[model samples]
Target chain A: MEKEKVKLRIYGMTCDDCVSTVTAGLKKQKGVIDVKVSLKDGTGEVNINNKEVKPEELLRNEVFTRPSHYKAIIIND
Target chain B: MSEPEKFDLVIIGRGAAAFSAAIKASELSNGEMTIAMVGTGPIGGTCVNVGCVPSKYLLEASHSVFKPAHPRMPGLHETEVKYDFSKIMEGLRSYVSHARDSKYVKVIENYSNVKLFTGLGSFLDKKTVVITGPDGKEVGKVSGSNILIATGSHPSIPNIKGLSNTGFITSDTIWEMNELPESVAIIGGGAIGLEIGQALLHFGSKVIVIEAMDSILPQTEGEIREALKKELESEGMRFYLRARVSAVSRSGNWKSLDVITHKGNEKITVKEIIVATGRQPNTEYLNLERVDVKTDPRGLIITSDTMKTSASGIYAAGDCVSKNMFLETLAAREGVVAVSNIFGENIKIDYNSTTWAVFTNPQVAGVGMTEREFSKMNGSCSTRTFSLLNLTKASITGETEGLIKIVVDPKDNRIVGMQILAPNATDIITEGAYAVRNGYTIDDVISTSHIFPSFSEGVKLAAQSFIRDISKMACCVE
Candidate 1:
């Protein structure tokens, strides 16, 4: 039940499985209600319920750039 | 005349498992293998004879009446369905006969090397099975290079005072009823119990379901079970969860049961009673100890992943065993696996990806790990639930009582588990089985492009809920 939508450009996703990994990781975060990651576009659209949680927090989330080879950066637009 | 019949394989049941094993063995031997199929019951086993075939036919027939009397569509008016119980059961019996002939009897006829023997097959030795007739005489003997014990199972009636002597029927013998009872109370809220209960309700019988557990279908997910309970309750099916039948009494044509629950005890009388507590394997008469074949504490034959029993040269599958369970298809698969492993295929069945269903109006089906299971395996896991309220298919059909849920492994977001409660959840769960079995992620389910405006879309939408807020999204948005 989140309403705030955010977009983030992703890096290092090689297969469709990576899309799911990123989606799950982002959705696992406490305020996130919805997440859609596209390996085709290297971008993800996300919905967050908490105003305290920012897009910048998702960028450095451990789900990306560790055991998994994915990275994210805030898309201001 | 003094020589015992020597066969390449001996199967101790003629049900799905035995027939499948025979076919596989024959195929492996290039139709040259001689097989002895020994059975105590009908040739097709419990399924076509007393289980799935008749049960499903009854479900469909009852649903036909149920749909019209309780019309969901606004444009459709409620219609009365006056059905003759005997005639409806006669048709079901006819269908069962046809299925037995087509699926089992004829299939066996194609295997010229297979000989069907009707008797109680018990172990004469590890390699030989002795067939005894019901008249307490030695009917035949089968000595084989290898043996399969697919003897299936029998209904396990709970030990309540006066219950046995009070007289009742099981799912098996219920097919023999000449008339549907005016009222019936079924003990045990398992799948078969509810199935028969609901079908009888639609046929105008006052149905009562009593379960020792707090909920029916104890193995099913909580949401799915509760949803079904609600639907069935709405349809006038009464439930007595957290209850046990303490005593029984027979008065003329009616039977009365003393039902004990935490609250209090109540005596209810009905025309008939169905004991559907559960099932136990048919290893009791197998004389497994004579052959050193070990059964578990509960009498289920123990087998390895390869479907090989503790005793070498012997295998077991189907309801008689603990692993494969009561589904006719799974039993057949286990039989094939046992036969294939005997032929050195080294095949093992993955039960995690296996699927099963109930035939109630809004059917329930599931595959792989449940949400709790996934959480237990992984310290924590993500789970998503989708309501059929948003489904176009449900909206169009005007039958919108359903829920679809997916359990995900957070690390990879793979669809580790799926369960559904819907009109066609049984059919839709196949895609979930394939996805879980093949390690397909939720995106894989979404990318598969399910047919638009179909019940199957519930699965895709469930997957989409992992990403999109479906309530606000446009129809079929990526």
Candidate 2:
């Protein structure tokens, strides 16, 4: 399985509680091996196995969906 | 009896302003300066005791209890959450007491040089204050080389025919309720009114908010005001704008208010009435006249930028003094600045960077100039707004009901003002305040990386909207 690192821009977090919630939510997603969320820069990075799931699918996971009021969009280099 | 107790400084009030002044003065003097804090009111003052702390706690509590029935998610089934009004009120009281003890009373215990005198203090002359006990007996007298009046303000009641006889409660008295009113008619649609009205409505009380002004939150941005009104209305709260009360009469347990609106004379009946009109300074009790301290027609102490009153060596701060806005933080800051200046350092209170917020459902927060203020300035300014609906975080949280608007100097692209109506608008407005205070341009905000999925990102998005259409840009794109 090929591992890929994806950087995302996150928005709507106001405190450290939001940061932790986001980190836990991303890590729970299928195929996501690791997740790092930053409160300072409002960015997140998720390392995942490309063979198990697509980045788009991970972004669209219920963990990152509505009700939590957090959104993540992959940054294109 | 014992020569008049002397001190380096005497603070007349025990609120945020007085505490801040005492702490700062003590820090500056390194425990050498003797200070006398004389006040008959509750030790912690308005913010912790009656104003912000208790009100916000109740608002948050109501929101939590109401969440089950009004959850924004589509798939979630509605459920009723029952709450004991008395228990909730008790909880609020406990929280206030604990906060006051820890934040104000306990903290003051450490400063040995600061003496706390619990009594009503009136200025006897320029340098003397006569303290009276609860029974109106002169307990003692204190004199200071420098005096800082931070007595704060009290809720103002409007004069209406038969109103006093019919009975009503103000913010100060609302907390004493053990049971929620079946229906409430709130007079005055300002921040306090709207916040309380919405909170009561959430707690299963029918609320009618009557504003004499053409609109609620007259000082807030017009768009934000309308949006908040709509949101609150959707939650079943009623609003009567441009309505004036002529008289009040009670029939049984119901109170009937004779109001004149554009529609004509009408009677509004409610179980209770809460006055959220406004507040007036505590200068009257201070006997400023005796000390020759100048005050405005409304009795607000007039002070210079350095918090110096018209009389030399007499300084004033908090709600007692005229300011662009009344806030606990601002009051505390003013107190610190006044103490700093009293110690021979010159510093002026800067209101331009002072951020204020209304703790409503979708909080209304702003810093710097409003659109109307900027227009009145007659300068080259342009404005841009970004809706929370466009933000993924708002969508995810189901709080996509507000927007962030920024007013900028078109020539230099510097932000002059920023207003936000959102869930965490109060917390996020600091970023905007910093930008406005530092004269940060749109490029500066857009260039600075903001947290992904945070309300603070709304600031950058608002700033980014000035040059490019945020809707068309990809995430994190400058």
Candidate 3:
């Protein structure tokens, strides 16, 4: 399986805890290897080792104030 | 080589959620947990900075000005009504600063396990976050085994043509303007738009709200929305429901907005335009693809009931994930849940327990299932409502325009939803949300103690009505 690092442009983050919240959430995933969160521009970077991750799986799992505000996209592979 | 400093946790937001999480993490550790915080805004996040705190102050100030001026009051004072936008904004700004400094920063800095980084934090990896100072200088990186993303959301600017060129401002941007526009068009009738719109209306703006939906407060009950619409319209604000704005143009200092109205094409000229079309998750930059996190079409980061995203060791909270009623209270709640779960506590978020309110004249609020939602879920549920005009407090406050609507599940008498349209509706709905969230029966509400002649009695009345037999409802007192 190809190794992929994904970047998530996060919105609705207010402080360092926001970055930590997302980082801690992603770190719980089974295939996730690394998680980086940026509070400056409201973005998160994550590393995965398998093809098991799907966007729907993530969307179905998170609790947000309004789920529509945040998005995760693959910037590289 | 010096050994790297190993921290137990790193949080990236400074709001109630971040600080609270830090406090909790500190307590959980054996006096050895190292927590790092990176935030760009003032110490407090949205709730204290640009969101609830400041907005509510402005709302209260304006409400005080308007409440005494209503026609229904017994005796009218010959006092002139006016709002100095700058002064009100100044006070709010000062309050926000104090809240951030005294409440947020002081707490974080005082925590022995926490390291505060007053800058923008970017992810070097899942375990490392690089902090950049306001001057664009690299401060340092804090690498933690567990990273929490509490970065809150911001206002979502739509993709309307020429919107940016027209110099339209969002809720976050409007706070800085020294002068309020005499005439302004607020697009999107959601909480932010409506709250700011009502504030501006009281502040002397001829506010016009253009909503894409058929009614304002879309998620609320129809009756409450209707009541709010009537009250706001009576207060001199205009509503253009089912209106779609196609283009915006600016000529010199004035602006022209082209809207596709239900009747036909219309052009509105206003001094300013506020696009409150709702907020998008601040995900465009966070390089989620690097971590393989998935988002919905609207850019909401996908997370689970546990606030965990797709990738391992990552978590998302606040408005960044897919959820509705993007409120500060909800965000704070989710923030606590996300962090606690990360520290090995197994807890799931309870969406049904969340309460939402739109700060408007005769404020609108809803909790649990709205009548619409309940009816959609089970076709047999019934509704009962109590008008504020029937309540003595409304007469005293002279705000008798809205009502309380309760949706009850007929089979088990569960209070599924409650909606309110009245002054202090946001504050009043908290009790109702607690009831509904706990699946309290309407009988419980009716049996509870309520102050005599209070607007909250309306809730008790509606609950009583729902608990009564159908024969009594059909032959009730006139």
Candidate 4:
């Protein structure tokens, strides 16, 4: 399987509690290999090995704060 | 075909809406069906976890702390009152944890057919739900005859210029801090903003509320808003009504707000800023297009009165749906209606009777139509109100600035709505909500006897004012 890295800019991750919640949610996805989330910048870096994974498919998984507070940006290579 | 993972139903949230649906769904199956569910936060949903329960508990504590230290210490007195913010938060968290552990878990434990799943649930299709556990594993994906979406909303911060660099906070994040701010600038004047604004003011912050509208709580009745404004003003709040914020930037240790007022541009500075504008529906997921479910451009799932979305065999409720009234009580009610319809019992949500309350000083509670909503309806309704100054209880409590108003359809004498601004406004408005919901008329409210010197007696007096025949009543009646 080919691997790719993606970044998710999230909101509502105020405390360590929120970080744990978001990290728990992302790790539950089908092909996510490893994840690192930051409470300060409100972003998550995920390593995915599923070549078929798409951005639209990722957006449909969990409830974020809103479109403004959270967004997923895919990184090239 | 491989043996199907079996269940009669599956639910996607763990809030008041989801649990209420679960309770009903379990009973309707006669203890012979399998049910599964999941939650992204703590076991309980928003209201219990963060939105209302914890905030109100903190509000009550802060109100007590801010109350006069002496039996009667008025005007101003120098006194020292310190709060252990971390301890208080720990207590609040423990309270929420105890409620969920003792109350919620027992409900599921006693039910025979109910099962709980702790993870994220996503739609594999209209009939299938895949559960993802906390440790990056697909725990299970099962199919069911019906599914309900009760995942609620989250805070929405406005797209303000320079806000990203300035560093700001929203209501959901406010609870995480153990340190109280010395001063704060609140960006919105809606229910959440005003509620938290009052709490922070009581906790000793020089709070400033900025509203783009001309007044705070714009949709509330005129008299209640005025009285609340007066009380909040007396508490030393600065209201920049009709003020639009242009930009925000950090200079040194403070954040500066660039606002445009009627006169022109002005700047205000504060230690911190909170964006409490409002919330957005949690419908970014479910691949709505794949199932033909329709949503607005903003992604609010559109549903009918029966709570059925545009797709077949799919239902939506709570904050995720567009027809949402946006209260925990309303969400729970909608959940029951949606499940009943899904199970072949037909019932539609009656949006007309929903009640709302804002926990400001003197508080604001409203049910059914307001004069504004009534005027917009143009349904031949007339309004009459009674002042708290006329009530003995108000005089005793020294809260004479509040009032109660009732609106009636003169053609049929039916009570259409009621509004109250009083000490127990939330508790009192439920009776009015019951009146409007059950088709009670003005005569019914007026003739209903209330205990002497009670808060709810205002409802009877307001109802009496709607009729013309007062002379025929007994003494002290009108």
Candidate 5:
């Protein structure tokens, strides 16, 4: 299976705790191979198996939905 | 009897400022610095003990109890929730104790170089302090190369006729009561009074808030203040603006307050009275004058940007020192800054981006200048506000009662200030703080993708409203 790296501009992270929360939430998503969230730049990068999961599907997951109060926008690079 | 103990740093008071200083000093010195902390009061200071922690806990409990009857959704039936006031108080005490233990006491135990002394510390000289126990006896003496006075503030009771004689409870003492008052007259409509007033009202108490000024929340924006007042008033909380309590006297089992308002003199009777006027610095016991340390007229210790008192090697932070605002985060930052400067780094405290919140039902928070402040300086600045009524998320949650106001400097389109009055304003204000701190413009905020059906989208909506009519735009339109 092929794997792809997706970079997202995460919003509403105020501290390291928020970064950890986003990292943990992303890692729980389907087909996610690895995740790294940065507080300094307010961005997150995740590697996922492209054959099994789509990047847009992961972007619309409940992890970035209401009640969690965080958002992520994929950056096309 | 023996020689006075000496160390590298001596911190007086055990609140946020003192703990922050000790922790930062320990980190900077790689846990090798010897420090002595003398505190006669509670260990965790105001934030963890009586001020923020307990108050917020009670507020949340009140919110839970009030939610059933005041559910905003249609077809949701009101349900009764019975509560034991004493049990709630017990829970609050336990929570405060747990927080203090985990956040302060246990954390301090790991710093082997730090010593804790439960006593009042007064300056013997520039580098020495005589510790006195609660019994007023001299316990011991400790000397240090540098000293920090983070002794926090206490609630200031007004000098009303017969006030002291009639007796009253303050925010500090009110927590000790097990039974809720049948009716409470909260004096001075500041943040504490308003918050406590609303909480008590929700907990089934008849609450009346009296403010000597024409408006409540004197420091907040006028629109925000009016909006909050209207909301609370609709919920049956009473308010007497521009009122002065001329006298307080007891009548049977009730307390009577003779208030002089704009209309005329009126008498208010309540089962209890809470004085939330303001706070004064805890510098009285520090013997600051004896040590020639300067203090403002209000008894707040005067300090330089580096947190240094008039006496060299003596520094102050937190509510004890003069600053634009008193907050736990700001106090901690000041402590860290002071320690960095002491360790040969040049740093100054900056409050331009300091954010604060009043924990009311619809929390009021602001970062940077208010509309009035901006108008006073520059008349050319543009302002935009979006009501929660138009925000999709607020409507979905049935909490469309607040508004977000953004003030921008049109010259460079940079956001100068932002004020939010919403259910989660406290959590959302930090985004505005970041924008104002980094000089982000309205376009920067609007371009960022906010989660749909989220309170934070209010920021983007307000920013978007500046360029085009938001009502004409689609839900996810840029």
Candidate 6:
């Protein structure tokens, strides 16, 4: 039942606006408890309720595909 | 022709019920079965399309305007709020569109087997349905082994003379109103009437509510109804009780209503008339008789607790089958039940546990049986009423105009029902509903802790009333 964390390298970022867009997207995901999107690193750190969601599902979220340019890939290591 | 289009299930609605059934059917069949969903009007049913979304949005939006001008706190300066009413209406429409696309339209996109058909679906026979376009031409035909009659309800216009010809707005058509009327006469005095009437009154409209019953919210707990009447009256909203609209006639620039109030017959004039008498199930064009589906005298489709119609392979749910309450959540639940029964399971809907709310300021909410219903059903029950004046939250917030009433069966000490009339009562009633649904005792309710200084704390205090005089109890006492 522990909270799970996922780090993603988000694309199509040019300004703080992209971070906000990604943050809103991550927050809307199921089981998402907390979301922190860094404009500098272009990374989205998400805390999720593990029972209802898995880390891999974040890569498949519509937020990445809707604009057809914004993308996210799970960061390894 | 070789053959007509065939589906595993043909759902007769695009709203909550049909959407819910489509999801359940997908789950049951593992995305293997075909589903044909036919609908009329908007895609998201009454709630998002016309009823809850736009109505509640305006209520809260206008609150920003109305509350500042009519300041509750004594020290606060009365500041006038101004805005273009048409722009606000436009904003409401946009919000409704976003909500519908997200909540209703996109929810079903995951199920590829479920197909959407835009038309009015009518039963050709028990197994077949024909879709008709707005032009009154036959659009298409589809037959399913199983059909779900999830067609919900529409606003009911009363039989008053010239009501239709003279023109009036119901919940369904009120969204089209761009300009705020100078004054309005709202009929029914029910949840729909009071909620919208209060919102318009907040927006500086001269609002008069006419109720055929002796009191507003006649179906709610008596004390809750009385408290609501008092609260609304204090806000300068007018009421005409034990009244009926005899006729409606439109004159130059205004309309006149011949109303038979308890005192005497009075002719009232208003710029707009809103009929909120109630809603009737959307079954008129369904041709249910062809399928041997039975309906109550009120024209609601009759279905078993399991959501099965009298006819085999046909099931009904939502406002079409609901006896008293018409809610989106209830409709979705009934849809699930119908789909489950169709797929061979016996899941019954427990009406006793159904929780609903009226979204007037100082909202009204209830779950389970009232003292009147409990006493009549079981012959005896104990009760307690906890006033908002005593609740620390209500006192601190300066919104002490409501009460919570809990009904307990004397024999078992189990809480049979709970009714609340207070700020955020709608959200708080869920706890009461959970208790009544599972036969939780008064002690159980008291054992669980509620957040202090919160409106929901009233539920705990009401439960505590059975054991001791909660009026003298210290705040935050265990």
Provide per-model DockQ scores. Answer: 0.01, 0.01, 0.03, 0.01, 0.01, 0.01
Estimate every model's Cα lDDT from 0 to 1. 0.86, 0.87, 0.75, 0.76, 0.87, 0.86
B157, model 6: CA deviation in Å?
A: 1.2
Q: How much is the lDDT of residue B409 in candidate 2?
A: 77
- List the candidate 3 regions with Cα displacement exceeding 4 Å: A1-77, B1-5, B132-139, B467-478
Give the Å shift of residue B332 in candidate 6: 0.5
TM-score of 5: 0.85
Query: Chain B TM per candidate, please?
Result: 0.98, 0.98, 0.92, 0.92, 0.98, 0.98
In candidate 2, what are the lDDT values of residues B36-106, reduced to their tens digit?
Answer: 99997789899998899989999999998888998887899898998898999999999999999999999
Worst 10 residues of 1 chain B by lDDT: B25-34
lDDT head-to-head 3 vs 6, winner: 6
User: Which candidate, 1 or 6, has the higher lDDT?
Assistant: 6
Candidate 4's displacement at residue B131, Å, is: 3.6
**In order, what are the TM-scores of chain A for the candidates?**
0.84, 0.90, 0.70, 0.74, 0.93, 0.88
**Among all candidates shown, the one with the greatest DockQ:** 3
TM per model? Answer: 0.85, 0.85, 0.81, 0.80, 0.85, 0.85
What does candidate 1's lDDT look like per residue over B364-442, in tens digits? Answer: 9999888888888789988888999999999988888899999989999899999999999999999999989999999
Retained native contacts per candidate, as fractions?
Answer: 0.00, 0.00, 0.00, 0.00, 0.00, 0.00
Q: Is candidate 4 or candidate 6 better by lDDT?
A: 6
The CA lDDT at B202 in model 6 is 88
**Residue-level error in angstroms, candidate 6, position A44:** 49
**Could you tell me which 10 consecutive residues in candidate 5 chain B have the lowest summed lDDT?**
B338-347
lDDT of 6 by residue, B110-223 (tens): 788888899999998888899999998888998886789989998888899998888999999898889999999999898899999988988989999999989998778899
CA error at residue B116 for candidate 6, angstroms: 1.2
Instruction: Between candidates 1 and 6, name the one with more favorable DockQ.
Output: 6
